[model samples]
Target chain A: MINRTTTAALAAAVAAAALMSSGANAQTANADKERCYGISMAGKNDCAATGNNSCAGQSKADYDAKAWKYVAKGSCATMEVTLKDGKKRMGTLAPM
Target chain B: MPAQPDGNGLTDLQHRFAHAVLQAPLAVPSGIRHDVRPTRERRFGVYRNNVKASLAAALAARFPVVARLVGDEFFTAMALVFIERHPPHSPVLAEYGAAFANFLEGFDPAADLPYLPDIARLEWSHHVAFHSADASAADIGRLAELPPEALGSVRLGLHPAMAVIASPWPIVSVWATNTHDATPEAPAAGWTGETALVTRPHLDVLVQRLPPGTDRLVAKLAQGIALGAAAEAVSRAHDSFDLATALSTLFGAGAITTLSQGSSS
Candidate 1:
């Protein structure tokens, strides 16, 4: 018969395995995410589809406001910025 | 003595290529030539220029705020020196510039900006946060579900992208003013110490200035200390430690990722 301590350890192990699987699922879900505009730093954009440049690291200004990096869908609005006017704004889904 | 290839070994070839990238174009490794031309010095020069430009661009990309503070010309010169000394060990360019902050501290030219190194440190933290793996924020409401006696043993885990940067200068203000303002104004008077929290809760990386004792508390919690012990440590150091406000800030910013009981038992 399994001891009480061993049973407790088994339950903990199962819980940990569940947590790890959930974390892995989240990573896979975010893998195919696309770039969200207004969050990329200068020359740090993943890629621009507007034909501006063929590769990453080409943006000419800080927070170019138009360039973006691939982020999970529904997360574009979560990239918040404090504007020059001291107003907070969320990153746009498309080039701005 | 003329440099000779070590019996055409791959290791030797890689060493020579590494040297070629770090040093002058004239020393471009032998037996390595352009695809179209055979060991053309001009073609090698083109490659050298591109490599240097791209590396410099990477530095600029990683440390834009630092670049703005030092101005373009000076920043480029400094970046060249840093690139020569500490060439990237990793293929990921985003992982570059880890030594930049420390380099600035020892750089004689940047002695005037005593705060420059700290600013670089802050920027590096921001860079790291931006690329760090994502994690779901902890559910603060779960704490209430725990029995009061078991609460003391709960260990908190920080988000994968969270970091605390403690500096003697008002680094958060300095970073904020320079980043948000088109024409950055002078630093505010009554400047004192600052402790900043860098976190990427969702898609955005946020840099927030922590209150007096929060950094200590967060640091302790991050070390896997249980709730009671971490709070007691903070209380001993700072009698005014506000647990409510600090917890609110931590949860609001999504800095805490996991909460597990019996870890410290």
Candidate 2:
């Protein structure tokens, strides 16, 4: 059951949290960062471009896995992975 | 089979059209005719391509990190198979891909990376939080006004846009490095797990790596557990659980939307 100490602790935590949040708000208020768009890699744009051919699928890849090979070009390629069996190896998107 | 007009002719036509669009595989629907240079077969292929491409684009937007993890070609191929199996039920493209993580779990080609599905789940949570309805944060001043005796029964209403994900993989780190421009060093060796908090407090959505044991406490609170009881339960289970830090994290994220003093007795 909660008693005086627990309640006091709660009060203190809430007060501290409030103070920290206000500071965070102030920091963000002056932040120079703004969201940018349209700079993503080919075919990875956040929204599709609407045009006369808007509904047409422009994707070069299809459902056949044999037609494509893992390129290991993304950031995931650089990461090191420790598998479930305790063996460590460099990460690749290719099927093992 | 070509669908013939029945009492519900429009519905049947729509069904056939959808089936042709998604499931014709390599063949064009026999019902279509083309008078232009492009044959009916070619025109149908274009239409089919457009449907899959646009939907794949939609999934790419939602799961950019996943796209980056595997290259574009593989991601598109995988997405096509997924799209054929799980087309969007709603017109809102944003609502699509709810089952993407589940699909990735059983996806054979990506089976080598066990953490891929968790990453998809993390991305989906971010997408949901980004689109959730906005609500004003609970006024901290009012919380301060409550008497100390009332603290035990404090019930917190979490923001509608808040979600917590606990994964045995370093999902947060992987998501961050892949999504952001400044590539930080990859997650270090011997890393065990990470718990991520996705919240949209105001204009932008925030994804934070939560402290250890904080997710447990937050999960309890999310279930409508009273603050004191939730804290006590988590503390009993996690030796390192800190009530103060947990409360601070929740409040800082504007995750607590309403606070009420329940019956103290």
Candidate 1 residue pairs in backbone clash: A34-A70, A35-A69, A35-A70
TM-score of each: 0.72, 0.75
Kindly state the fnat score of candidate 2.
0.34
lDDT of 1 by residue, B208-246 (tens): 777678899898997788876676678679987766556
lDDT of 2 at B92: 84
lDDT string, candidate 1, A1-96, tens digits: 333443343334333434443443322212346567777666656555464553345676655566776666677789887765677777887788
Computed on C-alphas against the true complex, the DockQ of each candidate is 0.06, 0.16
**Retained true contacts (fraction), each candidate:** 0.01, 0.34
* Candidate 2 local lDDT, B162-236, one digit each (tens): 988899998877876675533445775446798888888896667767777999888887778888788778878
Clashing pairs in 2: A56-B50, A57-B49, A57-B50
Q: Write the per-residue lDDT of candidate 2 for residues A14-94, one digit (tens) a residue.
A: 677667656554221112222222222333222223321221122232211111122223544454535445765553333
Pick out the ten consecutive residues of candidate 1 chain B with the lowest summed lDDT: B140-149
